[model samples]
Target: MKVIKLDAIDSTNDFLKALASQDELDNFTVVTAENQTKGKGQMGSKWQSESGKNLIMSALVKDFLYNNEQVFNLSIVVSLAVIETLKSFDIPNLCIKWPNDIMSYNKKIGGILIENTLKSDGRIVSVVGLGLNVNQTNFTELPHASSLAVITGNTFDKDILPALIIEKIQEKIGLWETNSTDFWKQYFNTLFKKGIPMPFKNGAGQNFMGIIQGVSSIGKIQILLEDDSVSEFDIKEVQMLY
Candidate 1:
């Protein structure tokens, strides 16, 4: 539970990763920054946030994963943790956009990006980066982006939110290790747009309509197609058009 707070950094994830490589770090060691000059998102997208107005952090996870197949479990654990934390603040309509985007009322509020390193001795370490809009209110350029303050109309303490989220992540990880079946059910239940007909665009920019059934064990989104067939697609292969 060692937390390091920074005024500015290029990326909390990069800082933690470099630190882990140099020293033996405890699990759940956290690094948070007020400003990230190069914050990143899924598929190389830049994460934009107003300095000191959001929650930007990364946590080190060690000895939690044994195999590559279990990597997606981290995504599930972190997603639910954020959702649950926001719920405590009375953030309404919280749901997880597939893979791991935090949404409220069909608007993007936060996001997660996990990076894993497999050791030569068969150990795995993960750096979980999270960016949540806490007090920020201006997203004029980004139409889909919104903040907790904007959604709830109440300002939040960014410092308190990250600690709760980290605690929830640890708690959910324990539950997942004990009974994965139940964990999967919880994740599916919070899945955004589940069982609803929606439009999707593939990598080739082809639009199609499908219903999100569930996610595969390997983290691919499973969609029920128009032909009554279920197909699993990788994150890069499909994009939900809302």
Candidate 2:
């Protein structure tokens, strides 16, 4: 798990995609940038960063590591990995919002982006990119953002951030290697809501309030409503309101 550190780049994920196009690469190969000029997030949303104060990195994983069914679970696995890693740094009260946002004290501190590519050999490659706020203190203009330093009131050494995150990713990634109950349990425990009615807009542009029941094995968010009937949503099929 060696990180190919960069002074700056457009997008680490794009850089690694080019590497995948050029030649064979090893799994767990990380490409991190000091600053990203054109970073994209889920739904092709922009992933903005404050250059040196944040963690901007992406990992290229080979097909043998995961498949379609496993890919959805991987998001939960990776998100949990990040949440646990931040906790290890003494950043408590960390919670994972549905899909891939890390929230603390009701504010966002990090985000994860997962991309899938198919190879000519009938295998899938997952490129997982992560953007975590680590040491910045001036996000007042960026309202929805906060840094680890702000929450913990201590600065993080950027030099070792990527490696530590990658190590945690590998550990959580291994949970998929076996049918570990803790994987799902950890994800569920960190779930955004237990039984309270949460406002959400489905992918179809419909707004509804449904109590989040837990994520299904198929990765769809299972929402239990006031009617006692359950409605399941595929990934990206539902979005929670701020």
**lDDT scores of the candidates, listed in order:** 0.93, 0.81
**The best candidate in terms of lDDT:** 1
TM-score of each: 0.98, 0.92
> Which ranges of candidate 1 are over 4 A from the true structure?
none
User: Candidate 2 regions off by >4 Å?
Assistant: 63-66
lDDT of 1 by residue, 1-242 (tens): 89999999999999999999999988999999999999999999999999999999999988778998999999988998898888888899999999899999989999999999998899999999999999999999999999999998889889987789989998987777687888788999999999999999999999999999999988999999999999999989999997
Estimate the lDDT of model 1. Answer: 0.93
Model 1 TM:
0.98
